[model samples]
Target: MLIYSILFPILAIIAIIVFFFRFRSGKLSLSSFFIWSIIWIFVIIFSIFPDSSMVFARVFGITRGLDFIIITAVVLLFYLGVKLYYKLDKLEDDVNKIVKEVAISNEISLDDEEEK
Candidate 1:
């Protein structure tokens, strides 16, 4: 429990730093980072309580802290999976747009060469 309390916050801090850097570089969306940070904070807060496992077990019908952790982790992983899927979709759209622009430029260049 003590180790979890310490490690959870440290991990959250690291995640925040990474997200901030990515956002600043315009590689990440602010909304996604903000939502992820909020979830991290919740996990950190829950980790601080020794009885958190018990609470989670009672409230969620889980058997143990490890189980609760697994459930939460799985849920978070799924959420991130969905988020990444959307981001990939956006990237694909951006790539298609750039490709179309390049094709148009090439066509115009070909027309100019023909005229000359």
Candidate 2:
């Protein structure tokens, strides 16, 4: 209990600081920043009110609060993992496209120089 009281708030604060830096540096968009902010806020709330999970679990037909928390965390992590995977795939495709374009342009220039 004491550990939870200390760790969760600290984690939440660190997350908020990171979000602010990312947003300010333009690494994160406004909508993404807000979404992450809300997620961290939920973490803080649940951490402070741990027993609330019991109520939530009952509503969801879960047998135990801890089980509910674990399940929710797993689902959230899986969703985030999938989202990151897609983003990375898209970034890789974009980089490949740019590289191909540059290579083709350079080869054409070299050919033109040889002709001249």
TM-score of each: 0.68, 0.85
Give the candidate number with the greatest TM-score: 2
lDDT of 1 by residue, 6-110 (tens): 998889889888988998899989897898788777777777875676776778888787788788889989988998999999999999999999999999999
TM-score of model 1 (CA atoms): 0.68
lDDT of candidates 1 onward, in order: 0.85, 0.91
- lDDT tens digits by residue: candidate 2, 51-74: 887998999999888899899889
Q: Pick out the ten consecutive residues of candidate 1 with the lowest summed lDDT.
A: 49-58
Model 2 regions more than 4 Å off: none
Query: How far is each candidate from the true structure, as Cα RMSD in Å?
Result: 3.2, 1.8
Residue 105 miss distance in model 1 (angstroms): 2.6
Candidate 2 lDDT at 93 equals 100
